[model samples]
Target: MSPYSQEVLKYLNLGIESELQAYVFYKKVMEKINDEETLEAVRKLAEDEKHHFLQLEDEYDKSVRSEMWAPYRDIMRKEGLPDIDEHISETHKELLARVDKLKTKREIFEVALELEKEAYELFAGFYEKTDDEEAKKLFQFLMNFEKGHVLTVENMLKNL
Candidate 1:
């Protein structure tokens, strides 16, 4: 594989891993909670995360074989610095610690809200930094989806 494809795979795999983690986390939360409303909400979120993971997986599969992969460019503004890596798994690890301690529906929704916001920021930063049109579009799509999750979480919190 070309260096460009390798770089793309790195980011795509990170995205896939993050979504999978989110799916598992949400599913676990749904399983632990007895409140039907909260259980249903978390179940839907888990499904959404699963859907996103599949989409990214498909993208990664196609990207590895496609000619659309572009050469690496400095997406970050630092004159000679490397592209900023989205260590979403690390962020999830931190959130998972806090999530494990939550004891209420409100607390659960609050954490979900924060996680969605963080995801939106991460993707938005990538969208802004990348010069590659396709990367920018992909980042934008992820960012927008995360933004919707933020809205959904906020609505869930309000209803709680």
Candidate 2:
């Protein structure tokens, strides 16, 4: 892979892995989530993350055509980074190292909200830099969904 594609894949995979991990993490946290409305929102957002995982997995599978993230899986695996159900695995260990620190229900929701905001901002930055229409569309969608997530978290926090 060219250096640019490799770089894109490495960074993009980190965000992708983060999303999948959040999906799994939220599912487990949902069991202990006390706020009914927050619980329902988390459930829905968890599903959204799963769907994003599937889309990214499909993109990874097509890396042969794009060379975007082909090496990500190997690096993530050798370093013991969590790979959301294998296919959407993270290609790095730095973010994975902090995964276990989210121990409480509120922490899970708050951290997820923060992560989503970071991802949305990252994608928004890329959306402006690259002329790729497909990527722009994907990032735009992610931004909107993440914006909604922030509102959800605000409501949950207010009630708490």
Candidate 3:
């Protein structure tokens, strides 16, 4: 994999980790919110995160053949490490960590918005750099997805 792909992969996983945290956080927020609209908004954001997760998984899977880690994956593995698969679900743990960092509903939204915006820029920059049609298309799709997350969170906040 090229340096560009590696960079994009890192950013994509970052977003995935954030989204997992967002999903659980937002689900908790829904419990605190009595307004139907606010609850709906939270649920929508959760769904959007789930969608983004699936998209990233599909794209990442394409890069790794036969369901095996590619060179890029190996590079991310620490030196003298057991194997990348050992940390294969690192994103899951990351999400839990982020959730542990949050103590309030507003904090969850703030962290989620920050993560989405960063992800948008990261994917958008990658989309602009690549001339590969398929890669560009995938990145663009991700860019829109992240931006949509920002909008969803903002709307939820406004409703609250």
lDDT of 1 by residue, 42-130 (tens): 77777677667667766776667543322111122223222223453343576567667888888877877876777678667766655
For each of the candidates, the C-alpha root-mean-square deviation to the true structure, in angstroms, is 10.8, 6.4, 8.2
Backbone atom clashes (below 3 Å) for every candidate: 0, 0, 0
Per-model TM-score versus the true fold: 0.71, 0.64, 0.61
Q: Which 10 successive residues of model 3 have the least lDDT summed?
A: 77-86
lDDT of 2 by residue, 1-160 (tens): 4323554455456557756666666655666677687778778877777666656655545653554544443333332223344434343343444455656766776777776777677667766765656666766777787678778777776666
- Residues 41-113, model 3: lDDT tens digits: 6677766665665566556666653243343234333332122232544545655466667766677678767
Native-to-model Cα distance after best TM-score fit, residue 58 in candidate 1, in Å: 1.5
> What clash count does candidate 1 reach?
0
Q: Could you give the candidate ranking by TM-score, starting with the highest?
A: 1, 2, 3
Ranked by lDDT from best down, the candidates are 1, 2, 3
Of candidate 2, the 10-residue stretch with the lowest lDDT total is 74-83
Q: Estimate every model's Cα lDDT from 0 to 1.
A: 0.66, 0.61, 0.60
Is 2 or 3 the stronger prediction by TM-score?
Answer: 2
What stretches of model 2 exceed 4 Å from their correct place? 1-12, 65-105
State the local distance difference test value for candidate 3.
0.60
